[model samples]
Target: MDVLLVEDDKWLGQAIEIGLTERDFQITWVRSGAAAIGELQRQEYQLLILDLGLPDIDGQRVLQSVRRKQLALPVMILTARDETDQVVQALDSGADDYVTKPFDLNELAARLRALYRRRGGHASAEIQVGSLRLNVNSHEVWVADDPVRLSRREFDLLQLLVSQQRRVFSREQLERQLHHDETPLESNALEVHIHNLRKKLKHKDWIETIRGIGYRFSCD
Candidate 1:
């Protein structure tokens, strides 16, 4: 999923962007609130990571503008302004969650995933598809009532695929969701993962392949 990151501190912005990218998130970092608003006007994003100390405009104003247009996008604000009044105002203004300054990247990623889960129709930590079940919080996967051991990459790949059952995702999309930095994904990494998963599943029906599009979880 694409995320718009609105942060003014150049160093913090770079650090957060790199950290989030490493977590398989597609981020577009902007330094000012105006550019952030402009991008929202043109394209779409699944989540917003906004900072209150924007250089051009207040982040609250941008949130208000986004709401005025009837776009119910999930937004989490990151800021040093953690006063009770400010926090309440932000929540009332439309922010889904807030993280004070000096936060951990892993925590942020978890929060973002949780927000996505709640917005995407499955708020629970456990997601099930077909005969497979995955616990997002515990990072465990089970196939056919038996626990399955998976490498971190394999688990992440499966999580991405099974989370959106029956949705076809292309190689490039999967690569973006799986690859970190310039780490080369031998063009066929997805095929390898799918093959490994299929073999592991050993079930006649699990994931289905689209002729020329991509792969999808068996909806039937």
Candidate 2:
């Protein structure tokens, strides 16, 4: 999963980033609401951890602008403001959840999971694809009834492909899902990952390569 953390406090920002990253989530951290808005426009994040007090633009305004754009991603407020009116206003203005400052990192993670679940988004735990099962929490992959060892990037790539099996994903789209740098990736990186996965999977044809297009995961 991808999350955008807009927190000004460096210590708390890094702490949240590291904690979520350990759970196989890719997080992009920004300091102010302006930066948060810019990043959200350019990228597709599954969730946002936004702080209400921002140095440049108020986080509330950022939240307002975000709701205006009408993206499907969920935003969770993480600010020191615990006032009842502010909390109600935030929820009214599209905040998915609220977390006061000094909140537990575990609590934040749980809320994010809950938001995703409520939105019918992906779970924080495992998901099944045919005979294969992917344990997202543990970053483990299994094919049929046996365990399958995969490199971190391979697993991430496969998870993206398998999760949306019917869709045709371009290399660029796959890169976004993998949360790599915005720069274009090497032409062969996707092919290389596919090759590695096929070798480990021992099913070279399970993933179909669309000529002159991209790749798709199809059982046939």
Best model per lDDT: 1
RMSD of each: 15.9, 15.6
lDDT of 1 by residue, 1-220 (tens): 7999999999999999999999999999999989999999888999999999888899999889878874568899999999999999999998899999999999999999989887767688888876788998888988778998777677887888887777888777777777865778886888888888778767635767777887777635
User: Model 2, which residues run further than 4 Å from truth?
Assistant: 121-220
What lDDT does candidate 1 reach at residue 87?
Answer: 98
**Reference-based lDDT, residue 106, model 1:** 98
Q: CA lDDT, every prediction?
A: 0.86, 0.85
Per-prediction count of colliding residue pairs? 0, 0
Clash list (residue pairs), candidate 2: none
In model 1, the runs with Cα more than 4 Å from the true position are 125-220
Clashing pairs for predicted structure model 1, backbone only: none
